[model samples]
Target: MTSTLFRALLAVLVVGLLVGQSDAWRRRRRRRRCPNPTDALSGAQTAWDATFMFECPGAQVIRRIRSAHCNTVEDRVWRFECGTVPGVSRFDEAFWSAWLNEYNGVMNFQCPFNAIVTGFRSEHRGNDRKWKLKCSKVNGMTTFNHAQSNYANEFDLPGDYTVPSGYYLRGMHSFHDGRRGDRRYQYQICLIDLP
Candidate 1:
């Protein structure tokens, strides 16, 4: 009886270990299947003043692009990307907003309701740049709504910027701010809840 009990106990232990390993393998497999952010392409390029970089948040992919030329010296361009998260399906329909301006300080634009900015239209007026954003909705995600600039002064200069993990790039704004023809850039990042 003692020997039989020991064998049964060992069998139970082996089964438990197998189950745990199976669960771990599934989790790893799912992670491997999850997508990675693609290469950052020129969302917008111009002969205006400066060059800057914008990238999608973790595991997100580029989905669209928008560009406009307000004048010879005031043209702007934007690239957009989207990806699947734990509670979100594919980005469905996309919409555009009317031109918006934020004067000399900041031109902050957030997608209304549960939408995210996928593309944009920018107009450089006298001393301000007005923006019209292309917004899109993620099918299953609603835990995030608003996007805000990561820097107070729109990062002041042009360079590379990436959205942190659990967040995505919603919009990008750049304008000729100083007298040296330098450009100031603003990146709007939106945070999402991950499982």
Candidate 2:
């Protein structure tokens, strides 16, 4: 009877260990698929360096790339230095250009403020579209003022635009003058964080 009881206890102990290990593995897998702010910015050690790093609320890890675009997956922030922005396919770009042109190069898009600006893609792609800074903040809101003429080839704004308080920069898009069929004119999209 003593030996049998001992064997039973051993089996239970082994089963418990296995169950605990399994649960731990599952937690790890889930973390990899969905990381919080802490996980996304895990290795950041300093404040904004005025070049790559920027100050983000509750972000434990922060990184930046000068001439690249941000590619977010799960809790990881990756960079792509290729021609067009990573994750944005060529098909999507063509569609956007055509649509922006039709709409007089005026568009407004917003995203959540969960992730701050890690980098920006300023390289002009097709349709002779380029980055332009119309305006940054207007009455506590980020606004993109459409230019009267879409013929400007490059950024001709008065100065660099900065994000206002409680706001963050997301991304940018270009829209050509859809009315005149002019490839030289396009609306420079300024994507911002939604309230």
Candidate 3:
């Protein structure tokens, strides 16, 4: 009986160890993205993980969403405002303008200089509701910090940003080696727009 118990315990230990190792491996794999095949082999990691959604009165809609995971301390969620457009909050064009417009944000793992993600959504049309979320190293600064957002917008804005209702809910991910100095920093930046 003693010998049998010892064997069962050993098996349990082995399985637990395997499970832990596999979890770590999966996280490592998630930290990688399709950046040029050669570049990936050279040592590439996800700079940031982010998304954007469209907001409206009826229901919260998801616009555009993308994630770039990396070797970080823990998972997080976030939200931000990407500015707004005039005379077209009800239409999709406003959302697209927020995307195509340049000089909006920065690309760094830790934003020491104070950068922000503005997730703008049309709220009651006249309200022109927009919220701004600043990226920080503390923890849980935005909405899309996790796999999903409770305040996700109405729906993804349709493509073709040239027409009257043409709009694009834009989302971007920026990554950097948080493990630079004495302490290695590994994190992702996420953003979700409102309706």
Candidate 4:
């Protein structure tokens, strides 16, 4: 009888151990499925353009962007790196306003799927000017966004412009000034609300 009781206790202990291990496995699986923000940016791909439109391929969100004037030409160039986020299968169709004739105005674009503006690219030539915005669906986010454009000259110090309390930087455009032999900047920022 003692031997039988020992076997039964051993069985109960083994079952408990198995159940605890299964719970741990499930927790690990859940963590693997839900990606952290940094994890979403780990597998990034870079796309650059001088005069053409730059778009992140297929549902990926832009994670970083860099813009500067081209060294050989009197034009601006931009590079954007993008990545995918787990559990976000697809993004809303990107939308942009018609290319305006002037470059220094407020350009606004909205997403139908309630996505937020993640990045932007602007084209500024003599007579042609336009902006393209990249959108991504993030959790605890809202729609109905607006962008404010600020020039470097607007601030006392260059590159010292501060983002508004609830806004974030979305795009940067640089123009080469032949007279100054330097580059000037215009920054586009979008509003965001935190929950």
Candidate 5:
């Protein structure tokens, strides 16, 4: 009777360990399936307002100046652009002005910059509105460059500039701002490249 009881206790112990291990394995799988969104950014001091990062699918190539342009793709739900330069120091003030455009109320850049030197301008035509985000290098300065447009206007814009150390180029755009209105769209450009 004693031997039989001992065998029964051993079986119970084995079954308990298996159940516990199975639960742990399940938790690990779940974590892998849905990783933390910020895990993609290597040097973020603050959390991004939005969750669920869009997969930026693109390839980087080396090319001469004035030879390539950063292009974006627009699907039914999102629009995005991304490009990479061989060196971060390649970007300069002239390159910003020549490559990036500031017309009406939209500013475009061929690659990410270290900062925004000027405030953004917003222009509107009927139901369509455009918000221009300028790039800069100096810190702690707030100024505007464009005149007031007849369209809807917004000034004093701030954004993530000054590329963090040990990072590179990335840009993203999405139409789903997770809002409940017609203005539920967002555009993002950054210089956080992680391995």
Candidate 6:
């Protein structure tokens, strides 16, 4: 009967649609190194600012933070919220002291830039988002020539920034001179986009 044929055709169509969807999913799973479903949901979240540094091809986006350390979510949020460089934290008291002695006391400056300076920041965080590390006191060094950059940031120390885990350092980049002066003191950080 035509009625039976109609039902049969409908079932076949449904099956074909399901098969196509499954194939697409399979293809996606195979393509990415991290087979985790969460990873699939969160694609690359990198973003960049148009005008920070002229040449930072490595990170696709880079911006400077003379005082604000956007490496941690806490610092980033403060910078984002105030739209200025965040003041040094209680945790950074030691660094502030050392820095003051190391260099001419860096004024409690503001976060400088707000966009990624480069397109290539490494993925330091895993799927977790709650890393409870703190910024430490750095001594005896006015300029740290870490892989971060040649320019020294008033806020950037080194190692284990207290950014929450799983959150990832997605698109940091704060500008310097929270006080406002010549842009020469400006520093930049280009972040890899977060999910």
Query: What would the TM-score be for candidate 5 when compared with the true structure?
Result: 0.23
Displacement of residue 8 (Cα, Å) in model 4 is: 99
Ranking by TM-score: 1, 4, 6, 2, 5, 3
Residue ranges of candidate 2 with Cα displaced over 4 Å: 35-195
lDDT of each: 0.51, 0.30, 0.29, 0.49, 0.30, 0.26
Better of 2 and 3 by lDDT: 2
Per-prediction tally of clashes: 3, 7, 42, 0, 5, 40
- Scored against the true structure, residue 3 in model 6 reaches a CA lDDT of 94
Q: lDDT, candidate 6, residue 118?
A: 19
How many residue pairs in model 6 have overlapping backbones? 40
Alpha-carbon TM-score of each model against the true structure: 0.46, 0.23, 0.20, 0.42, 0.23, 0.24
lDDT of 6 by residue, 1-195 (tens): 999999999999999999999999998766643223223222212211111112222222122222222222212111110111123121121211111111112322212222211122211121111111111221221212112223343443311222222111222222333233111222222222221
lDDT of 2 at 102: 25
> What local lDDT score does residue 141 receive in model 1, on the 0 to 100 scale?
47
Cα lDDT tens digits, model 4, 1-195, are 999999999999999999999999998877645233233333223222234556667766555454333222333334455655444566544565344224444443444345645555556554223566665655565533556555644211223344454454455465444443334555555654433
Among all windows of 10 consecutive residues in model 5, the one with the lowest summed lDDT is 65-74
After TM-score superposition, the amount by which residue 71's alpha carbon in candidate 5 deviates from its true location, in angstroms, is 26
Among the numbered candidates, top lDDT falls to 1
Write the residue-wise lDDT of candidate 2 on 1-195 in tens digits: 999999999999999999999999998777655333233344433211111222222211112211211112201122222122222221211101112122234443322222223223122222222322211222223334322223323222111233333223443334444332222222223333323
Task: Tell me the deviation in Å of residue 76 in model 5.
Answer: 19
Relative to the true structure, candidate 2 reaches a TM of 0.23
Off by over 4 Å in 1: 1-44, 47-89, 102-106, 125-128, 145-149, 152-156, 171-183, 193-195
Give the clashing residue pairs of candidate 4, or none: none
Cα deviation of 21 in candidate 6 (Å)? 1.9
